[model samples]
Target chain A: MSSSATINRSSAFSSPRVGQRNWEYATLYIFLAPFAVLTALFGIWPIAESIRVAFTDSYTALSDSPVYVGLDNFRAVLAEPAFHSSLWRTLVYTFLSVILNVSMAIGLAILLAHPRLSRGRTFFKLAIFLPVITPDVASFIVWKWMFNQNFGVVNQALLGLGLPPFAGVTQPGSAFVTLVLVEAWHHVGLYTLIFLTNLQLLDKSLDESAQIDGADRWQRFIHVTLPQLRPAITINTVYALIEFLKTFTVIFVITKGGPNFSTNFVSYYAYSKFNSAQYGEATAIATILFVIVFAVVAASYWYMEKGDQR
Target chain B: MSDGAVTDQARRSAVRATLESTVLYTVATAIALMFVYPFYWMLVSAFRSQEAILSAPLRLIPEHLDLTAFQTIASIGGTPLSSFAFNSVVITVLATAIGVCATGLGAYALYRNPRLPLFTSVRYSFLLTIMYPHMLLVIPLYFVSYKLNLLGSTLGIILVMSLVPLIFFIFVQFFRSVPQEMIEAARIDGASEWQILTLIIVPIAKPVILTATLVAFLLNWKQWFPVMVLSTGPETYTLPVALISLNTEYGINFQATMALSTLTVVPVVIVFVLTQQRVMGSFMAGAVKG
Candidate 1:
């Protein structure tokens, strides 16, 4: 319905008018004025100013006039061991999180979409998706409390089972794993729903033919079904990657980049810098992250376009 | 082959199928539990006394329904819970309301004047902003706010949060599906553009409006980074900020924090449950189109 509507709308829009009216032009700007002004001020202007601030000696947030110091902040950030570790940790976190979230989503989508599994599909979906809609801070705080070293229910449960208590976010080694788990728990539902929607829309004849050809379920899935799900795969992967890269609130609430800074990703690192009144370095770090994210988005977009052409 | 052999094979296959389904259900249930158990614990802990919450041999259910946690947070000296709730409501309502109007009007303009070069560029520019990391924009926005004297002001946060690109795109998508003929017919009958929009477009686009409004409200309500950065004092704190401050100040007052978390999450969960279909539909639309 929407696609056909889009087609018709585009065609009608392309039809040449005799002449564009003055009032139409006037109405266009008037209608657009609020969005335009807000976007310019809050959207575009900030990005432009951020890039500009990266090169200046604006140490304080209240600096009225900052002197130009081209590349100094960038140099300092690149040279700092803390920034390097944060960047490296961020990359690792993004990689792990994307893998976990995308795989979990695909797995759950396949399970829920299975023809034999009819009962409780809605129950399973609602359960998984509830966390996605829950307020982030509230949920993370709950997770943090649950993972408390001494009194946390998680440790208590383990001890009750006559097993050694697992160190959740209290130790550096397990903190990253715990963070990824919490992040994946909070996010996987959305990606799962996306994949599930695509799965339902898929043509089932291919799978049937593959089955007739004596293909096992795994063979059918990998050779036939998985190939058809490329678009959803790309979308979920990119979205999850971007989301984990900018992960802040969870770390802020749960770990505070503590237990030896194990979860101090780039976003939190930059935020900490900003909090302590180091505007130049913070924005520079932010600028670097922005460039990296932009490159990833552009690359995936190009990949999708190329795939579409084929 | 004998008929008995065939019957035996059929019975074996049926049993195998049932076993597979059982395994599938068990795995699905466990996964679902992992996602939902924390929320359950939060609710349970909220109703338990502080001692029970911290006690060993963890109880999954509260012994009694305790109101002390709620009372404690409510009566906490300096910046009561009501103030935080008030800030959240005011910010979310103002931002979502203005955001829907601005996005609807702008999307209508873009939809109608798709041929105009300026509008085309403007549309692309709005889309382009999505590629930038929010932190990049926000880091500099802190400076922008400071310079404009909006650093600690709720109005500043509302204005910043209102200009959502995703909402704009959703509006544009929905507006494109509205029959252009209705709009044109109204225009031909001497209805002004504003009249055509409010009377013709708005009524027809109620579902989209609701979806956009709900999404905008949720986004603004859960907003933490911007509010945290902008607000200088506790007076301007939203629920999320206030909740965090409570944690930091009290230092593991389990009952109170859980109570606050419950208070924060219950309304959102209720709203989501009531409008689950619409919310899910909007997300699917956004995801597929995006």
Candidate 2:
């Protein structure tokens, strides 16, 4: 009864004052209006339009009207051998890249966070992260040069060591491996940073208790530290999955979906379709890719939530 | 146990610790080198002649500084380097400025009225949109821009780029931590919401603003896919697009491409170096909180 009376008294005191400040609503709306309009136009509208266009026989960007063709676009896209290969390639690339990236990230995070290795923490962090901040096109272009077949530094180093020359984006056989490596290098830093942040926030007392209970470093990490890192692991896995699945910039710069379509992922494939004025089919591919990404992300979230409950 | 045995164990453990640190340092240094070597190579290659860059027994360091590649890029045919640089600057600046401001305002509005049904829905919608990949929007956006007569224009790019959902989320997160009592006090003092936001909130939120600005700047500056699809002509091409053209047009001129890449990268790198702490802090904030 006393708490209810206090709440009533506070509301009584503030209600009239807040009532008099009606202009605040207008100001707030004014502040929000531009962003809301822009989001609706560019952010929300495009998703809706893309889905709509996927079911239509739209060919050109300038076309005012496109005939609705139901699932024809999807059917056509699904029947194509190129689409099937690109989709498979995308999945394979995404799987390899995500695993490589997340593991490297975990390793680097642990290395950087180690107590004994105090010197040059900042240097290592900065060096790893430099690529993340460097303009993507520029860095990818530089990587392309570094991986050049005849004039590349990579081949030079390998040949100097009296080893057989590594094929760097020149041949179909090794292009996928090259793509994975370059993508991992470009992306692992951000994931590492994420893991490092999580590590810093971990409860140190749990590790101390494990140590006291006769757990060795590996056992403690597996039983205690790794559990604490579950959230970071989930986040990094999902992020890297989405990132590599839709990988475009690297392919655009390095391979252009070649050394004979070895590195042609789905995004680049859809881009090629779009360039050829197969708008309907292109949107269908995009819509399919979107569904896959959304479904995977949703599933991961659900799985993580279930894991947390346990 | 005897005191001598205890001392012996301590010394042995210390030696082992030293060995562990040595191994960790070696691994860390090697990894850092592997990550950083490409950048080092890029910088050096920019200043080397094409022949020197491709020569046998590749020199890690350039023998002599060469300005020919940089000069060549500066005056390449009909579309010069300056135009591309100018387009990039204009697009990045306009997009980041408008993006950061609009995002800040929207976030503030949501933060101030957390209970309002409309604002709550808007907030949730923004959160949901972040899940959709950029590629999914490209096709429709291209058509939309065409319909709106915004295709092949910087205006369209700026507007589209400014609709960044992540920045909005970041701003909202930052604002939520701000004490409500401060805003209430300002309200009671008859300071308008606009005044409170401008005078008080923005000042307190400088770090978030800087972080968002840096992110938006880098994103806009480096954007290739959308810009590539949207731009129909060389005149509208940004640095990245122009860099691609340079490669295709000149038929794999590594020296010139390196110089152009250097131009494109140096500004962002300099900004990043200057504000490294805040950028890292922002990433931590997003990771931990979001």
Candidate 3:
């Protein structure tokens, strides 16, 4: 509240702020200089350079200068068989993971919001949320152990149920499922927390009115609940989609996109190019990814706000 | 009677819910086991003999635990754990301090006038930066870092690694929640912009500032790409990079990997236990209330 008083005081005396001219801008400039320099020199430079690198024949062992190959990099990327396979796989992983993560999070948010579920409830959230904070490498190691083909907990539980022992990591499709499941499990906690928080902000009277109308648990959730949670759904979906697209460390830990390039995404492909010493081609891949990601984020924000405005 | 049938269906629904409650508890425990087991396994595996690791992979129960991995790590690396930890501490501390300050100032500037040049554009860019893949930025950014002679230096890693676009965006959103009258009072005091930012603004944001610090630290501590790119030697490498190297060099030994993994997660667990509320506060503010 004191901040309000201070803010009012400052805007009242706003003019002549910062010593009145370029000569007096030194203090602010000095404070801001470190960030601006670092971002410009490294952050923006790489992004710009990557675009330049994408338009040339930059993939060969013999070429140092990356001969002007105009659109060839894009053409080559599109033509590569693995590129299409990887792209499709990436899309599928992102789609399935986001849908599962967001939906379960929403469901859990509703369940956990029950007033009866109050006592000792914080423990439940912390239990689920622990994985979200676990470092990717460590969490990856844990999941790998759980998905162990023979002796891991998952298989152990399955066998304990008198079911057939599931073979693991030996097939591409099966591994993809395990990977997605692990990713979804790791992330659901964050969304649950997100959605649950949003749910708490809504009008209690609305839920009460529905109850007065003789609504039950499932009805309250579906009608009175779900529609009110759309804003959260939008945020959660955007976050999950971006995160799923950028997933590398987990996959790197589990299968290294293995049994072939079954789980590989564009980011990892870019990493592979760097390791392969095709710097230009690597930069090209990254540039394309940046463009794609940038476009998605921009369009989503534009549309989301437009929707909100209406 | 139709009424009897309706009652029967309701009974069936109640039974189904009881079954679901059982399922929920089971799923919850199973997830907890998955989440918590690695740390326990790490403790056991890190202590057990190498031969034990290979021969008894299915042994959920540890037969015998020893500190051979710990001893080895201690002897050759001569404080690999501590040094890696120390490096992480230094990097995280500086980055967080610098990050929060920038965020506070930027948020204040935007919130005060809302007419700041490119304010909306800045807001949009920060949002976009959340999706910005730093992994993809690794290669190209490495070249720039190399040119700047920042490669292999802690200073370089800290500076370049401090891009907090999301942090900035989140704070701007956070600042919007700060009542406008506070800014007005600060303005009325005839305080300089910096004075208003430092004295009046930051104190109000302490809770979220702490939350943001923890989040940023967790993110940076686990970050391997920039540190991996910059640090050429063991001494300079941060914990995550060192852990990765340990995994490969140790031949994917699960016990050792778990041990190192356990080490990486200790700070988060400790911080979560200590300040979970501050951390959860961020969620509370943004989420819609039920």
Candidate 4:
């Protein structure tokens, strides 16, 4: 129905605009021409060029002329251990980050959405949401200091309790855990705010209908809340995935993808290679990363459609 | 459940509200402290002398306030602290202006008639922009930026930064919500597409445009990544790049680093707060829709 309407509308403009309609269309294109030109130049062209360059042996960003070497860049990228490990790690990191953020966000939204509870809701919202707006470097510095082993508060409290020392950097697993913890802390605020906004717009009668049917708190949340929250959940999860793919500054300020590259996701690895003056390989990595992200997100959407009615 | 002595139930609810308020306040205060403490620590430490910093690890307040960090910010600066603000301002102003005008135009065009060829492409292109990552073009953009001599200039940054996908993200989403029938009605009265956009779409979508501008500008303004990668000269160093440099130089000096961090962050924070109404409005629209 929507497609036909769209097509019908489009065809009307396309066919015969001999009088006033012609002038309107001309003015419309005149307004849109600059944006279209810029998008084609900066947006589409770079993307196309990047994909094309990925098949070559261009290393440095300073290269003016480079001979194309077919299939070699892809082959090299595939053979790289860092590539494989970072690929797997990106999946794990993105999955853990998205799931935890979305769930916690929903939990927070539900708690704050209770209409009768009139006490500390505003303060809680501010406390959680402030971090979302804090500049990336400053937050990174604070988290880095928090995870510091020597005079850091986390370590101090742990020691006071007679717990064993945690070497956040020297140990591999702990470092990974710390990264996860930091990422989770940093992102939870944004997602929580998103869910809260969603919950506020919701119709109150849906939950009431469930409650009258003898649904307990957990039951109300599962059947009533989750079903109504499908749209929010979809938005939250999808955006989370996009964000996790683009994450750089947090890890850059803290770990720099350190502890022997244990935390080098596809995004960071591309940055690292670019930093190393390897433009050809870096672009290849980026292309691959883009492809990976595009594929995963598409697959998820396809799968979700199969599973859910929407 | 509430029928047993309504007055008693009311009293019980009052008591619960009070208790809940206290608990919530306490919990929130603790969390806020946790979030804000490191910057606080940095501020106090910045005022203390080096020896004092080493001696008193947990000083909540400095016994002697010093201007050493501020002095350092003034004297040892190639890109003065003001320049960072200047760079951010130029980018924010130019980029915001461009984004607002362009989105208004593109959105108006699409909203004027969604079925037009250019308008149809604009719709799909805007959607594509939202999905596409900016980082995908960093390397190629570097080559282009270098070739075009856009590597270090503020104008260069403004031009490219103005090309954000988020602009379309803002506009297209907003344009969709405004009814198309309004445009048709206006057209029926012999109003030009430009006139309809200016008088009708502009006024109705004013909140959205403002929101989009605020959000888009801040996103560009806070970003230091492109500057970090493309620009090498200190003269071109953005606040974020400069902050990173400070971190590298004085990793051990908590006082100067954090003080500078706070100083650099405050303007953006202030802007964020002021424009947050618009930000929240756009977000609410997205949340309700998605």
Instruction: Report the number of the highest-DockQ candidate.
Output: 1
What CAPRI grade goes to candidate 1? medium
Query: What is candidate 1's lDDT per residue for B75-173, written digit by digit as tens?
Result: 444778899999899988999999999988888888887877577767766766776777657788888888788999999989988976668767867
DockQ, model 4, C-alpha based:
0.39
Cα RMSD of all models vs. native, in order, equals: 5.0, 4.2, 5.4, 5.4
- Can you write out model 2's per-residue Cα lDDT over B44-122, one digit (the tens) per residue? 8889988777675268778989989898888655788889889899988999999999888888887888676477666
TM-score for model 2?
Answer: 0.93
Question: Model 4, B86-160: lDDT tens per residue?
Answer: 776777778778867876687667666678865676566655544556665666667667777878777666666
**Proportion of native contacts in model 3?**
0.34
**What C-alpha lDDT does candidate 4 achieve relative to the native structure?**
0.71
Instruction: Return the top candidate by TM-score.
Output: 2
Per-residue lDDT for B42 in model 1? Answer: 90
True-vs-predicted CA distance for residue B78, candidate 4, Å: 3.2
- Minimal lDDT window, size 10, model 2 chain A: A1-10
- Candidate number that wins on lDDT, 3 or 4: 4
Candidate 2's DockQ is 0.51
Docking class of 4: acceptable
Q: Which candidate do you rate higher for TM-score, 2 or 3? A: 2
* Model 3 alpha-carbon drift over 4 Å, by segment: A1-31, A56-68, A212-216, B1-34, B47-64, B75-81, B113-128, B179-181, B283-290
- Tell me the tens digit of each residue's lDDT in model 1 across A265-301: 8988988888787888888999999888988888999
lDDT of 4 at A220: 83
Which pairs in model 2 have colliding backbones? none
lDDT for residue A236 in candidate 1, whole number 0-100 = 94
Candidate 3 per-residue C-alpha lDDT over A1-93 given as tens digits, one digit per residue, 9 for 90 to 100: 555644565465556344333322444455444544555555667666566667655554224555777777777777888777777788888
lDDT of 2 at A128: 88
For residues A2-70, could you state the per-residue lDDT of candidate 4 as single tens digits? 345435545666463454567778998888876776666556666767776776676533567676888
